[model samples]
Target: MNTEVVEEKSTKDRTVVRKALTYFVLIALIFISAIMVVFEVYEYRYDYRQMSSLLRNEDDLNAEWGRLLIEQQTFGATAQIGTRAVTQLRMYSPPPSDTVVISLPSTAQQK
Candidate 1:
């Protein structure tokens, strides 16, 4: 009877120790998983910010490109060219009374 009691007590001790070890392992795994989740969230937020900054830069470049196109059109207009020619180069069109026209003979007539 005494030997049986000792063996039973040892088995109970082993059961308790095994249960404690299992609980420790589970807690450790939970902690590691939580840390990984935090890192993933941080990485996602960082990428989002980078993408937003790139989008804003693209928008600014597009706006600048639009403005440059408008400026080019304004400078290249016929009225703008005529005004610049008159003001800068002092050029003018002749009056109809001072103009003359001439017609040339055709190649067939020459042949």
Candidate 2:
């Protein structure tokens, strides 16, 4: 009877220790998972902010692109270029009597 009691007490102590260890491991896993989730949420918020900033920059760049395109159109107009060329570069249109036409002979015609 004494030996049986000692054996049962030892077995009960081992069972208690096992349950405590299992609970400890379970709590540790839950804590680690919570920390990982928090980190992921933080990272997601950071990336979202960065993406929003980039989108704003893209919008600003698009506006600048539109302005540049308008400027290009204004500068590259034929009448504007011709007027500037005449006024700044002292160019003039030739008279009709000074005009000459040149013709290129086609290879098919020669053949």
Candidate 3:
């Protein structure tokens, strides 16, 4: 009878040990999953910051491009060129009486 009692007690102890081990494994899995979630959140925030910086850089470049286009237009205008020539270089258009026309010989005629 004592031997039977000892066997039953050992079986109960084994069952308790198995339950504890199962609970420990489940808790470990939950902790690991929480850590992974935190890591993913950090990565997401980092990517958002980098994207924001790139967008700001793109906006600055676009503004610079607009300025450059405006400068080109100012430089390339015919009126601006004529004004600069007249004022800075003392150039003028000739009167009709002083105008002369000279026609160059054509290549076909020379041949």
Candidate 4:
């Protein structure tokens, strides 16, 4: 009877230890999962901020590109080129009396 009691007590002690270990492992896993979640949230926020900054930069670049395009068109105009030529290069067009016109015969007429 004494030996049976000792055996039962030992079994109960092992069961208690097992339960404690299981609980500890479960709590540790929960803590680790919580930390991972916090890290993920932080990383997500960081990425979002970076993306927003990139978008703003893209918008600025697009606006600059539009301005550049307008400037290009302004500079490439024929009137602007003619004005530059007259002012900078001292060039001018000849009078109508000095101009000459030549007409070429058509292929059918030649044939």
What are the lDDT figures for the candidates, one per model? 0.97, 0.97, 0.97, 0.97
Give the better candidate number (3 or 4) by TM-score. Answer: 4
Q: List the residue pairs that clash in candidate 1.
A: none
Ranking, TM-score, top scorer first: 4, 2, 3, 1
Candidate 3 achieves a global lDDT of: 0.97
60-104 per-residue lDDT for model 2 (tens digits): 999999999998898779778898999999999899999998999
Per-residue accuracy of model 1 over 3-83 as CA lDDT, tens digit each: 999999999999999999999999999999999999999999999999999999999999999999998898789788899
Predicted structure 3: clash tally: 0
- Off-target runs (Cα >4 Å) in candidate 2 are 78-111
Model 1, which residues run further than 4 Å from truth? 78-111
- With a 3 Å backbone cut-off (N, CA, C), the pairs that clash in candidate 3 are none
Which RMSD values do the candidates have, in order? 6.2, 7.9, 5.9, 7.0
The RMSD (Cα, Å) of candidate 3 is 5.9
Candidate with the greatest TM-score versus the true structure: 4
TM-score of each: 0.62, 0.70, 0.64, 0.72
In model 3, the worst 10-residue window by lDDT is 72-81
Determine which window of 10 residues in candidate 4 has minimal summed lDDT: 72-81
Q: What stretches of model 3 exceed 4 Å from their correct place? A: 78-111
Tell me the tens digit of each residue's lDDT in model 3 across 1-111.
Answer: 999999999999999999999999999999999999999999999999999999999999999999999988987897888989999999999999999999999999998
